[model samples]
Target chain A: MKKLINGVDQIVSEMVEGLVAAHPDKLRAIENTNVIVRADAPVQGKVALISGGGSGHEPAHAGYVGEGLLDAAVSGEVFTSPTPDQVLEAIKAVDSGAGVLLIVKNYSGDVMNFDMAADLAEAEDITVKQVVIRDDVAISNPDDRRGVAGTTLVHMIAGAAAAEGKSLDEVEAIAQGVADNVRSMGVSLAPCTVPASGKPGFTLEENEMEIGTGIHGEQGVERRELMQADAVTEELVQHVLDDMHLNDGSEVALMINGQGATPLMELYIVARKAIQLLKDRGIHVKKTFVGEYMTSLEMTGCSVTILNLDEERKRLLLSGRE
Target chain B: MKKLINGVDQIVSEMVEGLVAAHPDKLRAIENTNVIVRADAPVQGKVALISGGGSGHEPAHAGYVGEGLLDAAVSGEVFTSPTPDQVLEAIKAVDSGAGVLLIVKNYSGDVMNFDMAADLAEAEDITVKQVVIRDDVAISNPDDRRGVAGTTLVHMIAGAAAAEGKSLDEVEAIAQGVADNVRSMGVSLAPCTVPASGKPGFTLEENEMEIGTGIHGEQGVERRELMQADAVTEELVQHVLDDMHLNDGSEVALMINGQGATPLMELYIVARKAIQLLKDRGIHVKKTFVGEYMTSLEMTGCSVTILNLDEERKRLLLSGRE
Candidate 1:
């Protein structure tokens, strides 16, 4: 209700307009469509990369569209999956002769829609491949684990590979490699209200916090009394390390992500604990990113993602162009 | 307060520790001192640029320290100014043979303390000059205007000048010129709770908001009901334009800064409006930065900063070296 949008129906459209308008040289929104493609998309002989999902998470799919990232991003209404046609438009807009690769998060809706888009692209004789990122360590069922911040890492690695003129299969393999190695877990201090709903999806007592909350305000594994910053971060970090089988001497690229509404100060505090704990376990941190990469529409909390790094993965991850 | 912090008394120290830990290659903390310096500090023959303020504003002073932005940043406790000795220590640590330039926000504590530090540096035979940025337009008296987000512009420009090997006087003049030309104003949807204070700085009804609120929750010019996003952005943009005396064909760098808790979605909405309105007036936007450049600790709202640019500033502002 307190959101600064004119109407819930216009949130996605207006946001796409604003994003393309803000970065005219870097991005372009397809006419009358909720798809944003790089201004110079469809580079000849280069594998194109496309990704997208719900609208509330700004800078995730769209903000990453540039030279070294996604070639296109399709957006849905807030917290809702984009229609298959929208994804198809993005695919068609960015497909070069080399082919196209889609990075879909593991959410059921996202996976279904992106897969349909790939099918549509294939019908047009466009060579297309897809990888579903299931990186959240919170869910016990691997098939049910929803992608979180770690999906951004997948986009970076896969996008870089595509930008390097790799074959569609090569890009797909790297995307899947990142998907298999990355793990993320989040904690929420409060719930977020979708603009259309104007009501919180869920509620928590003032003294309680949710561990492993979904980006859309889905119930976490547990809601418990708030703990200190280090303790909360320790829980998420341990979950990720355990889930990924990262042991002593493992190297990683750490992402300390704020789930919308969390401040950089708190994110750094969480990062401090994460880094210290990882060091204690003799894990080497190759790179550290601390900021809001993915968000949950003003929900308060943080997520920690660790991408186990190999030479190829590290090269592509660090190869971000912009 | 639902903040992710351990001890309020240790927040500043711990945050700095985390920052340096995460960016060990780029930054380092002065041992036992609340100061962050570039890892390769005291670059011979390069004018050193330093800035600092209260600790709560993460990424302002410290985060800006890098190759082409700042050489050193001193930190005070939360919402408190660093003492003169702390500033003096920063000056000493980063003073190359060329000189040192101090960029101080126009808070009473900061001005007095930095001036004292400048005097201390002179006593120690270190060539030092200072510029106090006054960019907020809400206050009627120019002398009383508080430096808000526009201080970042001063840093970018002056630091670039210093890094470009400009003379001490040249860098000071450029910084002062930026401070004089830039204008900023903010609106807050909710009050922030400082960790040590464990309570909101001020309270607002659910539907209420504050215009021209200071970065540290200082009282703004008006407390009013929230309006549509465009209308709010229009008011801020008009105020800044009026204060800057900008007109048709003016070229400027626009910054849509989110006060920590505001989501990027809202910031982009605000940026959309700001850009459209400026274009309506035939103003040419040379560059646009939309993000949490400077922030109030988890305060929900945003600020708009416009730096009317001349050729020198246009070049220097765009001269950020990573």
Candidate 2:
């Protein structure tokens, strides 16, 4: 109902300005653009990492830009892809002689823009590589598997490798490795995101929820009844565990992220059961991370992601490079 | 409303267990106790740091337990204080011969339980000092000020010093300086938290917001009419700036934190205008952080906090030790 914004339209631009004002030491905002870059760019020898997507997934495409993550991130309006020109400018800003790697989520618009940018940049004599993360197991391909929440792993693995001066070939390889291993699934009981319009995005009836939801406030596969955390987790994790194809005695890394409205306490409760669910199957979970890594604008629910780790993923998980 | 919880009473305990399971390398849950400790606490002769309040602020007491902040944290049930015994156990679990420093938010229940633990720990010859953060500028009476979002700064600044191996007294001095300089104020358009019974904690009709809200879903100072983000930030920042007694040309670290339900884009938009408002008044903002640091469960709104900064405070902030 009530909001603290100047214009419904200027929300993203305004936020970018404030972030630059706050972290000049770590970042800089391009004039009149949705791109934020590290103060140090075109390092002459290292591959640059570029990422961007909708604006609502804060700290995701941008907050993660620092020493170990993205070199530049172009932000679109809430839940929308940055235009091709915006992505093109970002590529121009961060591209070094070493080439640029575009970390893309498997969204149609995102794929189109980044792919176009890659073609443009390559035409300009700058080499570019792109990786599309389709790690969300929530969507079954019986209809069509869609991308959801596991993109964080791809970012970390690729960003870490890029920051370490790894070759584009090596970085893309590691990103592919991580992407192949991670899977995410989400469900929401209520819809609560404040769009740039200064209005809450969607409203769920008092007794309704959109289950198997996506981060953009998109309706899920079904609006199943919202149940207890344990029961919800049981259904969610079963989907993830089965999707990951982890059998008894498998080892993994789990992330239980809030879609905004879920509190810290309940996230932990859900994650606690998720661990037991895995343990009961003799699946050895080596690591776990729980928090709002990537979120839908103030939506209240939690998603569980399991990264079935192998020797390579385990090494990259601990590797603090990017 | 849909929820993912068993009996409401078991929410906090169950969540704590999940956090423990999530980050065994980074955190360890106290056996049969509602406390969490950094896996590598009590390094040789470093002062241990512990902070906790209610259960809703995650990655807070628990989320912050890794490398940069907090050696240990004790969580109370949702909106409740941890028992004194739990505090004592957390203190003992992390206390080295170098002693421990307790950082307590100035909530009445929090103060009493932490102080009770201090007295209990003192009886056992453990040297302990306390820094009570009462920085919410929204509340009147400095002594009666309610600690809000700025309390996180206390934990971080003190946690940095402690990790850098500052003596207990030195850490206390730095934490006190942060506690003295920081101020926070919160607003909410709704009140919906999970009670152990898995029901909404408080209800706010659409278009109604509780101004000057509290962390545990406390009734706000005024059920005033809600407005745009620009107006919201003006009211909240003005409250903080005035109550903190900051004048023109003051440099502060600004934060526009969501109370769960508000989106980051909207929060950033608000921060944009708030920054403009301050600049117009001749104040220089040295830093800005916009996200959901402390949240009211599923409430759709944002809060603003400012921490006055000097060279020393800035140094302490920039110097984040392992």
The local lDDT score (0 to 100) that residue A264 gets in candidate 2 is 70
| Two-chain complex of model 2, DockQ on C-alpha atoms against the true structure | 0.65
Candidate 2 chain A minimal-lDDT segment of 10 residues: A140-149
DockQ, every prediction? 0.75, 0.65
Q: Write the per-residue lDDT of candidate 1 for residues B183-253, one digit (tens) a residue.
A: 99999998888887799999989898899899999899999898888889999999888887778998999
Residue-level lDDT tens digits of model 2 in B1-322: 5566777778777877887787777788888988889888766688998998887765566777867688888988776788899999999988988998898888889999999999999999999899998877666889988777787777777888887878999999999998898888788777765575456667777767777887766766778766777777788888887866677877777878777667666776777787888889888887677777777666677778888887766777767631
Per-residue C-alpha lDDT of model 2 across residues A213-320, encoded as one tens digit per residue: 888776676776657788888888888777667878777888888887677777888989999999999998887777778887767888999888887677766775
Residue B300 local lDDT, model 2:
70
**TM-score of each predicted structure versus truth:** 0.98, 0.93
lDDT assessment of candidate 2: 0.79
- A239-311, model 1: which lDDT tens digit per residue? 8887877779988999999988888888998999999999999999988999889898899999999999999
